[model samples]
Target: MKLSSPENQAETAVTSSLQAFLETDIAPKANRLDTDTIALQRALSQLNQFQFLGLRVPKVYGGLEASLLTFRQVQALIPRYSGAFAFLQTQHQSAASLLANSENQVLKERYLPAMAKGETLMGVGFSQLRRTHNPPLTAIPVEGGYQLAGKVPWITGYGYFQYFIIGATLPDGKALYGVVPLIPTPQPEGGNLEFSSPMQLSVMNATNTVAATVENWFLSEEEVLFIKPANAIHDSDKKNVLHHGFYALGCARAGLDILENNAGKKELPFLEESHQTLAQKHQSLSEAMFAALPPTETSFQYRLSLRVKAIHLAQRCAHAAVISSSGAANAQSHPAQRVYREALLFSVSGQTKAVMEASLNTIADYV
Candidate 1:
């Protein structure tokens, strides 16, 4: 896990490159267009030039083939410059991971290399999988393929993503996953596919997130990824919550960085002590979480607990930055205020019922 290790040297190089990009390009305009969807497109194009869209893709497909740990580290650095950028990139990375790990040879051959080379960008539309009420999206077997009919509540990076990986439940109680174009030509009126206007939000409005409805959308066999039983999906999801902690930690680290840079000699000792304490906790929890990869139920529970802790610490650190800056931090453009808003996003991102229950139980013990 050491950054200096030979196995991790490539990760170091990527991180260094991202750091330079953040400082030189992203940070300068991070607060300039919080309400502009076009801003995300520009940032994504810049990221494509750096091969960031392919960070996790296999080397054979022209990607950097970074390890999961390295991917988390790079993700952690992104929110420091722009949380919306990090959020969109996370969706892209998730899609890339799905394509890379799919069992369908044709699906892999058709998309992985294009995705790795930045010629294709895919978004994820699986939030419907978490709904507790009403039936989930269903797939009906048809002559040439399956017909998908249902609604996907939230999909980010809308205009920027050419395609999306959607999930539907089969009648026999299996999950069906496929990649479909976001905007198909010959608009299907009340058929096939349609999307709503972008949602307005208190923050990260630049991401262009939207809701979509698919009415008997046909997904040919070649378009399908892998189908798994419901239980398998549940099992896989439980172990994947740890990477989200890095996003919160990244915002916290950004706040701390701002505080340290602005503090005078007299304020240095107190600020440094606070920074070190949180940094140590973040490092310790990160190590433990990764060590438990492909986690068992016990380890999954532990990871959720640590995730909650990281979220609260991020909020605290961001709040501390606001305090240090006094009245100036009240400005919407202030980095401290931005980090504070970004910290709120971590609570909901990648959230599940199990994670929610665990977070609540942990909070109750202190209350």
Candidate 2:
């Protein structure tokens, strides 16, 4: 319950508690929750009560400000039980990250404590790729503050969250961050927030993705948070490095766990060597990703460069795990199959394989 202290003992305690909860409460019912919204809600409510949702919020707002390393450890462990559940939990932490970075005190005070206590849920709308094919969607300014009128293709956790952080373009065409409430709307099918399922592919089937529209959605002066300075992609990239680092680490650890469990149960040649090599590669990549993200340090585009390398390493590890799993992994019911599928989700963390590849190529050109 102590906040702001980086203690190994606390982390160990949290890990043990979470593992016990997953085993007793989550594992037995994970299958049911995978496609059941109500079950997911019940589990998430448990997570909230345990303060898992507020693990990274600052102590002043009733959060523990848990160390990033501890956060990563928890994320890794959660996927061992269920990747779907783990991702839902991570979204809360991501919300905490947004709260931590925002410059608006009023917004922080109003939402952070409630979010920490799990009385409210938070979602972010920043994944827009403009229909016009702009660099990214921008927030244009309007009367008083700004009007956010764009489409974010994949806003996760749509119906469940009560608040959202939106990115928009100002009138001068400056990119800005804004916050809005997702409540008190007109009646819709018995008054619940309407949600549409995203087109499903492989991993994270139950994440509840939806396309969000904020058409001329106006924000008052109080709701506008920080407008990132131009040419701050370095800082942006650095932050994303940390975020995606944890994500990749979580998926890799899940994959490694599957690999370790299935090791020596087969007659595959060089199995030990394969496992060891993959483990080493994953570890090195994880370290590199962590090393690239220095807390509070801002630079232009360095984060993006590091992210490209880190994701490539993660893809390699995921591929290796699947190939090594071979005949045993072919079954969709197999844990290895699940891990393999989940691993592919890492490549789309920002949602465009083409852009990701292009960015990596651009970085490589300079290197």
Candidate 3:
């Protein structure tokens, strides 16, 4: 699809707005985190002002309602300035997508407008779906709603997001999806909700990821989104791997840009050749993956392969960036080092068992 087509004009406008925002508001403070954490209030406020927090929400709800390809393009723009900001924004986009596609009109009416207006922010707590056996959280049917118990391993944007879309497995093996307020009023009355301190990570430490323990927390029908059987969830999830690919590609592109800018005159030949090769690969894979949207099993596998390739390319480009920067790259504040760490995060992000096994098998064949 031609990105410059009239159909994509709206998307182009949003992208342009995002670029301006990144250059002005986010870039200067992108590397400077206060106490190793972002002050999300200011960041979120800026995102709201730009209407970026609702980039994917439907126009009916007062959002820009960008296309999926356009959304991916926007995703690729942010990590160049701040990986932590990009990561956090991606989760909000995911949550908005879920809400946009939900079957519950009441829920949508209640939250979608608020989300679009940036009055409400949402996080995701569905990483437990990655577990192949013995899921961390479970659901039990009660008179009014489902009772939730156990822990959610990771939920980012803790302080910023007021709500989260959490998934739990039912007794009949279907997946139960619901939204719960992160900070309940009056302290949940009886210790039903609790959260751990934010985790410290090697990279993206400013995102403020946290773990939550829910003990018999109740979610009524009003709060529940849509429930899906295991097969349906798997089918939906397999198509999402491409989003990760775009993020990795963004990091790789950032590194390549840094490397090219810093290359000495004598080193320009090698840097130019490497840059062209990686850029061509990135464009080809990105086009192929987007063309395979509404992914079938075969397409899903193909996209997974592309995801692996993107991660590998990002790592190589990040390393090349560091090498080009030489001793200067070793500093804690070096952009090359930050890009390198961000590249490492792609390997584990959005990982499922099938993806993990496929990546391992691919590496084994290469070795």
Candidate 4:
């Protein structure tokens, strides 16, 4: 991969833009939100207007064509304002990234442009618990293309998204992925689809993760796109995992920013000494963690592990910030409330803390 000189500058620009949005749009509405439904949709629309939704698409498709590193930096910024918005943006980019590997020239030309324009949203359909989330090779030949029958749980942006990239099993049990356009057409007697309320979440209340079921859904051959080897797709998936890892970075930064901005206010005579000690400890710890990441394959795992650790650390920072703020900081009206909620959400992304720990251990063992 070619490292570009503009990557850092791009990251800085994205961060600054997101911070501005958070301060102006998202923060004011966090408390006044109507039903969570209205709040989430509104946030998404605002982000789309800023073209944050197409951060990963190629410039040819009207995207910023940002490097993976740049995208990670942007991801970190989203949670600083709204974790839900960040989560949604991640889903959109993930789908767009998958489209990069697509073979259907027509599909790519059609959808990629629309995605860049923010006229459409894309999501993944690969959360079958029993099976690994590799691409599907299933070619259950049907009249149009194939009958894609499979149960996918935990679709992040279901119901609201227009395009969903689905994974399924070929008759031979190999995995293949299909890009299905989820248009809101007429339904059957009961319903062709069932939408659920947001799963009660510990954090990231704005990200509406919902379970979905698709029965023998018909997909045109164009929808099948390129059913390439799963290993070919793994490389991109790894990049995405790392990029998503930046969410923790943003959360931790937000927590630390809040803490530092109010440090003097936190200085009581008794706690002043402890406050200085905590600040130094966190600073050194963070520096060491950041330094441990060298730009190598091994560093990928290290960075990922650190991101998970950072999520927990950020939560600690938030706790400290609230405590240092003398309890009034925990009020729902305070920005810290939203930041704290996002900190919790950052800790429990689609892959939970335990799962991430296992992945880290696996990566270390492999190395």
Candidate 5:
């Protein structure tokens, strides 16, 4: 798909095609995907048909094997069309990437090819491993493998994904990652896995976020994805901290799209002028974040500062979109309201203690 090149702003065939597909199919019905499960599932299936489900999977696994820049571009591009679509599909893509990197050849071969082609869709629920409090979920060593017990606080895409990779803490503070069914599993080997109803949320509700109460859920060795030492996720979060900002970057674009559209519809000179100013700020932030990506010596603190800036910029752009949309933005179906809520998600998604402090500090104008 001509996915990668040296430049960040350079348009690739993949991104161009994705943009065309999104604008034609997804953008027009962004609001519907938030509330309509059938429409959202159809949109996801179309994405699979186009092979975008495999962007991060290795070529050996029937994936595009695109560079990080290419994947990040897709990350930014999708949310502009539909935040719900972006939010839902990313869970599958994350699972694919993890499988691609797994040492379990059997597990990788069993899942990666199908995952890449969306023949066997998957979701991920490892965020609970990042919580500072006692692990909401725990893993106990057993003869064949480990038994998972406790609650998986968040696992999006219930019906859309048949399976998901779960993370639970072990006694030594390490974590066990395993692929398990998304459905309520029977009490095989004297264990049970049950999920709650779809979580009611302000945004991306159609994605069917759910929680699981896993009681001694037997996980065979073949089902294990991988295991990591203590503090691995935290260290990884610090390294890839800027990745989620790509969503905010695209959301800023969504807000600007609405602001510019309203500027023309209302023919308000002040709105147009405000759009121009915000657009420039968005551009500067986008470039700085992109340049700080890979092959650069950008320090952790600097990248974090860029992330904080992107979060704040997204909120500002969303506010502007809401202001331009005027009183009508209060409607649930309003695009401005959708983009505003998306901005809220990006502000806190993948948040760590350090990111939280920085984001809150920026919120307080403590910059």
Candidate 6:
């Protein structure tokens, strides 16, 4: 939990590095990134060249090991240029963060160093465990390690990641996290990893999100990342409740950028005023969200409220951009249109029941 440096200085360094990369490389190609697999792949690689992929890994593991605020700053800045890259990179960063906390030295050594440099890439598939129902994925103890069987309803980065960390419930009411192949691979015991065609999502479909059936797949000890109590995600969610809001904040900025540009082009006084009003609101929300990051500083309920506010602002800002742009914004590739769609995705990116409720209430207030 130690920060890398003073907050302001760290923020500047991270923001400048990411902004330079995004403006120079991603902005010109933003419109095509939504469905261009090659463009997404190249973007992912180029991010690695700048060591962005390793932002969360420990410094000892050769990562930039940025402060949490700095890391979240990157999250907010990225979607301003390309939502697909923002969405895709977050998956890998999540995997790297999980691995960095592992008690399994062997697994840490195998992945952390390479992950820090983007020499290795991975994804995560465990959100299904959030549902309180018959487990969609389960693991049973075996001679060598554990046997995992069932379905992973959502696994992104199919063609982009070589391996991914899958989470499944254990009979003892614990959660088992282990590395599994991202590609299709048959097991010896009439078992296999089979994936459906990449889903055509409303946004970031280029990340190749797909469901998988893991039938009798054996997860060896060497590949095991860690095991935690069943409530781990719920607890983690409480602690990191504000984490995903930064993406929405970034998306809001994207909308404002479009709105400001259009205002200048059209010389509309009202549009300019609208941009300033919305920009100030976004700034206020941004500051409040950052100030509330310390777990002890705010109640979970308040943090949840801030998170929902961020979600609503993103939607509102994007909606404003759409309204200001007139007919041309209807183009399938319009930046405003894309940012609007991204707003929808970020609204529920890491939604829990409380988050879901809070977000709906915010929308209802607008209605």
Tens digits of lDDT, candidate 5, 1-367? 7754543333376678889999998999999998899999999999765668888888788888778878888888898888899999999989988888889999999988988888999999989998757999999999988988999989999999999999999999998899999998886478898999999998999999999999988899999988899899999999998989999999999999999999999998999999999999989988898899889878999999998988888899999999999999999989999999999998988889989999888778854
Q: At residue 107, what lDDT does model 4 achieve?
A: 80
- What is residue 352's positional error in candidate 6, in angstroms? 0.8
Tens digit per residue, CA lDDT, model 2, 1-367 = 8655456676677778888999899866655555566788788889865677788788889886777767766765686567678777677677778877788899889988988899888877665522224534456555676555555566667557777776664545456767765543433322222334564757566667676555456577798777765435334543454465456566676666556655667656576677788788777766665555446475435555555655565556666667777786787666666666666676566534433765468547863
lDDT of 5: 0.90
What are the clash counts of all predictions, listed in order? Answer: 0, 12, 0, 8, 0, 0
Per residue, candidate 3 scores C-alpha lDDT tens digits across 197-291 of 88988887777888889888888888898888876667766867776777887888778877777764437687777777767876776676567
Q: Candidate 6, residues 206-291: lDDT per residue as tens digits?
A: 98999999999999998998999889989999888999999999999999999999999999999999999999999999999888
The lDDT per prediction is 0.78, 0.66, 0.79, 0.63, 0.90, 0.89
RMSD of each: 2.9, 5.1, 2.8, 5.3, 2.5, 2.4
TM-score of each: 0.90, 0.78, 0.91, 0.77, 0.96, 0.96
Which model, 1 or 5, shows the larger TM-score? 5
lDDT-based ranking: 5, 6, 3, 1, 2, 4
Candidate 5 lDDT at 87 equals: 94
Q: Which residue pairs come into collision in candidate 6?
A: none
List candidate 6 stretches off by more than 4 Å.
1-14
Model 2's number of clashes is 12
Model 1 regions lying over 4 Å from their true place: 1-8, 184-190, 265-273, 290-298
Better of 1 and 4 by TM-score: 1
**In candidate 4, what are the lDDT values of residues 224-339, reduced to their tens digit?**
76555434344444444444456766666666666666766645564465456555655665555545433534544655666556656667667766766667786776666667
Worst 10 residues of 3 by lDDT: 182-191
- The Cα RMSD in angstroms, rounded to one decimal, for candidate 2 relative to the true structure is 5.1
Q: Write the per-residue lDDT of candidate 1 for residues 53-131, one digit (tens) a residue.
A: 8898888888888887678778778887888888888888999998888988888888888888778899999877655
